[model samples]
Target: MDRWTWPAWVGVFGGLLVFAGLFLPAVVWQSRRYGRLSARRLLGTAALAVYGVALIAYTLLPLPSGDLAQWCAEHGVGGVQLHPLQFIADIRRDTAGLGLRSTLTSVAVLQVVFNVLLFLPWGIFARGFAGWGVLRSTVTAALASLLIEVTQFTGIFGLIGCSYRLGDVDDLLTNTLGGLLGALVAPLVLRWMPRPAELVQDRGRARPVTALRRWLGMLVDVVAVSVLGAGLGIGWTLVGYALGDRTASAPEVLTGLLPVALVLWLPLLIGSGASLGQRAMWLEPRWSTGEGLARGNLPRRIIRGLCGAGGWGVLTLIHGAGPALAAFVLITALAVPFTRGRRGPSCALTGAELVDARAVSPAVPRAAASTDR
Candidate 1:
């Protein structure tokens, strides 16, 4: 039980780290793939990540920490157990002369049950989340079990030098059976999860401009700037070390100017006036004239970019601008919910409108279409 508890804790902590790293990318993907976010699907995805880590922790963890040779000699088991239904005999032998209740609760019986239960989620996720058929799910589960057993048999492929845990064929059979059972009941278990086909069908539809979407777009921008800046900073530091320039460090200009220009300015000057994040979230700023139609132009796009993330980036490079930047971020964030079309400070100041990239402009009147022509 202690072994199990520690692995579960490790899985939980590792899962959180994995989710944090993947959250932005997941949001962008869900937005694009589904044309909107589904909280239920996101929760399920997170659970799957937890399960993945937990599975690895359970199968191979608590490696011989000290005196590998002594530990293996003391605790290691035979290389393999190839006999099927061996757990049945072992359970009976271990529970001999015990009452029916005691036999059912014996360690041998519980061990078999745990092995079956361990892989049950694998089948459920396969059928419910991945939408795989029973045969495919069962086969995959069996193959996965085989791989785990093989890894144990080879002592993690010779890294540990010798087998420390038994590689049991009975465990594989039980686990595959559990997976098969889960696949059979997956439809009922995951009735609320949106099917992949359903999301694909709705992919072309334009979703409303909401506050969450706006915030997500901003998050993407922040993440892009941070990643680009860090990568350049590291590269510059490495170059300095290689060239014997011990005092060389990342200049504020190189780290600050380039990422902002590439991520914000270039996009605003080009098609759609959408920053990288905005493009990822299917959002773009247009010149809103308080008329039915809104379009983008170069000058206003530049102003909008400056008033938004690009401005924030520049201020970050300037020392003693922290308070102003904080105020700008707060005001922009607050303006999203209250402003028309959910425009932030950037869009409001420049008279730019935020819209879904998929939104089609209203068809022009025949006379209007011909007049321009």
Candidate 2:
């Protein structure tokens, strides 16, 4: 056996450490929050299986034989070295070949299609963890790709004397695009093959939370709402100011508009969070109608967060006529229900309901389940 280098050891150890840290947290959080969705369990298991298969293939597959490496060396390009820029240049040059143009186009298309397919599972698993949304799911997918790339680059270089893996910037770009593509497709997949809900069930009946737990939950919700809303509001204000009035400093406008924008948009942000965040936290937010947060779903949640309060923040800072008027209308409408013991506009728009986080039983493994639903 060949001797492993320092880099190899670092790569191997580092990969393990990183994977362990990330995997453990994701599993714990998902298990606790979503409970058991048989569909999610199956999808997760399938993803792991595919990943393992890919890893095995990557290891056992023959390297571009000695001839190819020798050819590369003769051509003045160092073999088994990190040359990201050079690799991209080579790709561009090769794409211009006369006879190979058609073949290259086909290959490029196939590569993109496969890449998109590869991350579909990641998107699905991420949605189960964070709820279905393009941005959140895409972010999760990108992070996952980064971890994989770093592990591969570091581990391979350490174990072997040379960097056997070509760490291309293209991979990061492609992987993220793929992940987003997958996330975009997830909603459709979910609609057809819904996630199973038996994997994380609790054995006992739902127990009412003690005072401490209830208080803690409320605190968590409040902090999450405030931080998320404030951050989004600030971001929108900066963008609005930057695009509309280049003369005024974004900071100046943002600071001046912060309080009013926050006050007007607070209900929407809090109410949306009350619905979506509760779902992510593995609790169902039900309204007086006995319906859980009206599948206000991901799209609605994002609009409420980004457009409602966040937009109001930007408008407030800019003193924009349209947004301010819209904000006033929304605020007034929300306030109307307050007279009758109902919640604010967000609750009305999304049909906000009650929130309950009771544990059920873990789902039965997919393989063990009967075909009949």
Candidate 3:
């Protein structure tokens, strides 16, 4: 790969993610601070993203080590550079015989630059997002490098059977130095960031009813439920296999019902009247106005879930996922336009109503009020 190519790829990918962040408000109706991301959060999120990208690139790029890797494994050997300044020594040797141009073209020179530059974001992120000071940032940088080197040194913890890359002490030094430099310069580059302490907090987003918000929340729920179901089903099957039970099965209902129950129960139990989906959309199911949800309306929530995703899943399980899935999606989607306020056809099934759960002042209890006086 060209020296500049990896950074360019990171730039393009990171730019796309930033662009996607703009649409998050349309999909998610609430967050810690909803709507727009403050400058601090934006910078913090961006720094996090860039750091993650560099980490992946540095550790895992030049994939498919192929036959050479297998040969090395058979021979029981791999590359290592335990001595510090090995990079400088190699560069100096090349330049002495072949001139300075030889040093510029050398892979050793690029390795030093990329290794050092790769970790700069770690220092910036430690201070900027995590609120670590200089000393903490340096320690964090050292720890991170140690982990990376160990991973390389062990060949992805022996799964690959041999190390494909050289684990070098100089890389650690350069990476730590890069992080320290980034930490030192972070205040200047991030001067415009908003301090969360001084900034206004979100009370959540509320509107009479919004179809898009409702859809977005439901979408998040669908993904959550699917992931939950798959995890449960897969884990059960694996457990059964490990125990040597030939008849062990991973049931579809096990996947669907458990996740559905937890999603409905936990948040309501937490005194948030919202399900995971409703919370994402900043709307909650309310049996009555101004009520705390210590115990929820399980019947209503389950009814809504069935109407949204649980129903579709049951159909898929019973009818076998092809035409039934397609038909359900079409009918539900077309029904939205005819339904008043797009509140969903199922909302009427159990007399359940979706309420905007944002911005109402918390009601003080009588005992607490009296104690305050």
Candidate 4:
């Protein structure tokens, strides 16, 4: 549309970044709890967010133009079709012949078609992700359509002085029909893909530690640490200014260490045993056999942090690490993929192993274990 311009592109880019910022944590959480992250699941998550955003853009965009006061005075917003058959009649009127142009090229017909197609995803997702059937999907589609109409009627929550878009009954009818169609077609696609119920069932299955999961956890942990560092950097600047030193160097080195203490060390000391990333990815450090959830004590956490990536390794940027620090980082990073069970070098020294935190299996009697031994 003519409305999509440089500013629209910028808004889209910013929206995507914001969506990713929020969605990544949820993906990590789902992966942690579900014990697996499939390509399908990742795409599904992205598609859901994109679809919702697209609807908002399509329905509430090209915002009211010209002077608000003048536009409100003219007031071209309040319009609706309470007649359910009005759109169908309009489509019939748009057609001039039985040819392809008459059937598909009419702008009125296309607009009506788009309105119906817009909610197709609602049906697909309702069945594929949430396992909704025809009745539920219909209800959901009706409610969502109502919301869109209400948003149009309300002039985007009253930011605009008056409504600039029309609320239509035909849209409600077509969208609901489209949703019902989508729900009916869902089983066909679902027959070829993972069922929603199966995915839910997989949530309870025990999963072992893996290199990929550990890496994901660490990646999230890196972001968590950087955020902490930035916050600390800001605080340090404030303190410097308060002391009448406007040009004082910020405590950037100390900034990185606080995250190591809070996200890594503090949890071990408190018996949670998982960093922010570890919690997100469902990884936990074990201390010993039969000690289940072996979150280390304070000394162990401090020792591990200094020796591994979570500890002093993060200070490489601010403190400028020597060859020893470089080697430690390289070795620890390499050991994760090469070592059996992908154990971190820090784990070797700390006498702990990172395991799947939420993993579980049917428990046999203690006497059964003795008998097997």
Arrange candidates by TM-score, descending.
Answer: 1, 4, 3, 2
Residue range 1-373, candidate 3, lDDT tens digits: 5645775576558645754664454335324345323545754665566557657665755544567566565653467788988888888875676767777778778778877787787887777655679889988898889888877777677766777566878888998998998788877766666544444443433445556656766666667767788899889988998999868878756876677666544554555446677676656554432443222366666666577555655565564577877887777656654665455655555455555555332442223222111
Clashing pairs counted in every model: 0, 24, 0, 2
In candidate 1, stretches whose alpha carbon ends up further than 4 angstroms from where it belongs are 232-255, 288-294, 361-373
**For model 3, the run of ten residues with the poorest summed lDDT:** 364-373
Give lDDT tens digits, candidate 1, residues 1-373: 6975877887788988888788888888888887888788888788888888888898887677688788788887765899999888898789999999999889899888888888898889999988789999999999998998888888899888789778999989988988888888889999898877788898867777888889999989888988998899999999999999978999877788888777767777777778888888778666634344356667777788789988887787778999999998898788889987787889888876677766745422223222211
Best model number under TM-score:
1
- Whole-model lDDT per candidate: 0.81, 0.45, 0.63, 0.68
Model 2 / residue 76 / CA error / Å = 14
The TM-score of predicted model 3 comes to 0.68
Per-residue alpha-carbon lDDT of candidate 2 for residues 1-373, written as tens digits (9 for 90 to 100): 2221333343445545555444433433543544422345544544444454453333222233455445334532233334444444555655665466564565554454555565666676556433557888888778766665654555343443333455455555666777787677676655544443433345123333222222333333334445555676667767778789545433543444444344433433453343322333343333332221233455555454443334434554554477666665466344633522233344346544222334321222222211111
Query: Which of the two candidates, 3 or 4, achieves a greater TM-score against the reference?
Result: 4
- Which model, 1 or 3, shows the larger lDDT? 1
Angstrom error of the Cα, residue 132, model 1: value is 2.3
Q: Is candidate 1 or candidate 2 better by TM-score?
A: 1
